[model samples]
Target: MTDFDQFEDEDDTPKSKTQIKREMEALQEIGKKLLQLSKSQQKKVPMSDTLRDALNEADRIKQHEATRRHLQYIGKVMRSEDHQAIEQRLALFDTTSAAYNKLFHQLELKRDALIGENSKEELANYLDEHPEVEDIQTLRNLIRQSQKEVSQQGKTTNRKKLFRFLRETEEKRLGLAE
Candidate 1:
């Protein structure tokens, strides 16, 4: 009916106080999860130096009230960070995450190929593709062991070792290894 009323009607609605509080709580929960991660795991997640320092401090705080306050500070710091990127990296550490499962399956397939009937050619191709493979001899040895076990229908101890080696190689390639 008046100029003020018209301006209010045209303005976009701001977030309600309750909405803001809920969002803050969600970020705090994320901070709590980050704190739960080991030091090595924390390094994998991309974060600003300030946030990293805050997390480190949070780790040292043992008193109940001080720890609680520091967690809130962490939540504040996390507000300025890329939540999605942090979550994606964190999900890599979770075995149930789709990304983790996909990587695991791919490694399994590669390991199987390396120990399969066509392993000689597959190993050659794999080495060519991943020239960064540090210990070619060890990889070949493991593959050979796994192949022998498969042919004899024996327990797959070497196959497991081969899979583990492949996983370690992948982690190093991805810069997730120490």
Candidate 2:
């Protein structure tokens, strides 16, 4: 049987010190990761008052040993709580990061297509997908400006603006409220 299976059996067997220490270390690692998260992201993590306090205290601490001790305390609190739920919530932040990366790449492709020879077809496709985008005339102007700037001055001032506009519009398409 696997080591974990032995712990699950009906027989009354005490876990070894090594197993206990390993679990504590793993929990402390999770606590450290939580501290590394941005304030807004950390706000979304479900945790008890004690655990939250410990994390806040850890943030204030600059000393190495003291911060390490606070982390251990946070791990102790974690042991008594449902860390699985905490982990699942933390995993959502990772998905958000991935989603943003994918969205940015899609916007980059749209910007490239908007400047290409088949730009009319690309613009039509974009309008079809985002009918609410009322600034078709503006996008067209920006695209023309971007091309002129690139061909003449070798600059991308209007091109960057076009990309920013595409990024914000795609954010709405992705259902990211504002």
Candidate 3:
């Protein structure tokens, strides 16, 4: 048959063999990332029985050679499934981490300010912004205790308690917690 006759009539353009190989390799990378997820997170990804079994087996294997081989099989299985959906779930985990880190740094800065000499005014500002926080005197005592412990070079348990309280209070305000 002639070269043009040998080509399938179904498509306007056929993908090169190298392009198909790259696509398969990209799916393999996604499968590797899926292996890094927690078991519950793994379950969130759509999976065929064969793909599920492959992932479970991969997780339980400590041997490098076996894991490498199983991972290749996972890529083959993933080819028949909706890999894009699984990738979207992974992307959500990444986005939340960046936002969580920003909030954590902000809380740390406020916690440090509360343990400093000018804490009363700083604490009042926080209270003004969060009037839902009752028992203001309890927080005052904790701050006093934290400062005293710092002066004596003692354990900063009260300081830690104040930070946790601040984080939880913020979580409640933002409706991220009950």
Worst window of 10 by summed lDDT in candidate 3:
1-10
Q: What is the C-alpha lDDT of each candidate?
A: 0.85, 0.78, 0.78
In candidate 2, which residue ranges exceed 4 Å CA deviation? 1-34, 37-57, 69-104, 130-137, 150-153, 171-178
- What is candidate 1's lDDT per residue for 1-178, written digit by digit as tens? 5312322323666556666667667778888888889999999888999999998888788899998888788877777799888887777788889999999999999999988889889999898888889899999899999989999998989999999999988888777787
> How do all models score by TM-score?
0.80, 0.50, 0.48
The lowest-lDDT stretch of 10 consecutive residues in candidate 1 is 1-10
Instruction: Estimate the overall C-alpha local distance difference test score of candidate 2.
Output: 0.78
Tens-place lDDT per residue, model 3, 4-101, is 33233367676666766777689889889888887766766667888888888886888989888877888888877888777765664453665566
Against the correct fold, how does model 3 do in TM-score?
0.48
Tens digits of lDDT, candidate 2, 77-152: 8876678877765664565656556666788888988888888899889899899797889999988887787669
